[model samples]
Target: MNVGEWAAVIGAAGSLLGGGGFFVARATVKAARATAAAQQAAALATAAPAQQAANLAVLEATVRRVDEENGALRGEQARFRSLLRAFAWTVDRWAGQMHRAGIEPEPVHPLVEEYNRTGV
Candidate 1:
């Protein structure tokens, strides 16, 4: 109705609008922060399985290397056994020859048999 009253009304309306705008801006900022956090979590979730697979691949390779080493050790064991058996056979043949010539080979018989007990 009066110019002074009208000015007062306009001033109150402007204050309300300015306060509401500030609140809205603050809410927008909070929502943006929450969205950014959610996106980061999703990125980590997506990469987790790929990281696990890479770790498993490394473990599998280590297992294969160990298996190969075990195979090499088995081959070495077989060679050692063959060498022991050959030595035992040579001792036995020497004993037989000595026996035919009327020489007693009893003293070395037990030493040669020591090689046979290792397989058990």
Candidate 2:
């Protein structure tokens, strides 16, 4: 073959080989990426259930704690109400005693004012 024809043939062969190599490399890279993506997806799918279970356990624990606290607060409220009732009864008895002793009933406001002034 003539020099120009040989050059043309060599150039065509080189272009074909390069194109084929690029195609193979592209396909390999694509396959690797697809495999990595699938692995990642599988990992996430497996972890999702575990994460949800953990979250549920935490929520249940919180609910139990809240329920215990609420029960304690309810008991405290009952005791406070009982103490307030006793205080009211005692105050009524004292007022009755003052009335029976012929002492003029002082206004509760004066006693509160005096206590505030004394800081006692």
Candidate 3:
């Protein structure tokens, strides 16, 4: 072949090689980005369960504390109800005593009469 023809052939071969190399480089970059994204997703997937566990633990602790407070409030309410009942009984006894001695007693409060009726 002539030198000029040989040079043309070499130029064509170099262009084809350069173009193929550029495509290969671009594909490699795309694959690398995909791998990086997959790794980030995997890391987040692993951390999600741990974060959920932490949140659940906090919720359980809050529930336990609320239960304890509820128990204390229940006890206080029972004590207050007992005192109220005792007061109502004393008022009834005083009114009975005054009636027996022929003295006119003042009327009992409506709330006290309702409590006596309901026995609640």
Highest lDDT model number:
3
Q: Where is the poorest 10-residue window by lDDT in model 2?
A: 111-120
TM-score of each: 0.52, 0.65, 0.67
lDDT of 2 by residue, 45-91 (tens): 99999999999999999999999999999999999878766776677
Question: How many clashes show up per model?
Answer: 0, 0, 0
Model 3 over residues 23-56: C-alpha lDDT tens digits? 5555556666777799999999999999999999
lDDT of 1 by residue, 50-70 (tens): 999999999999999999999
For candidate 3, list the clashing residue pairs, or say none: none
Q: Flag clash pairs in model 1.
A: none
lDDT of 3: 0.81
Off by over 4 Å in 1: 1-43, 106-119
Q: Which pairs of residues collide in candidate 2?
A: none
Off by over 4 Å in 3: 1-33
Candidates ranked by lDDT: 3, 1, 2
Ten contiguous residues with the weakest lDDT in model 3: 2-11
CA-lDDT, candidates in order: 0.76, 0.74, 0.81
lDDT of 3 at 41: 99
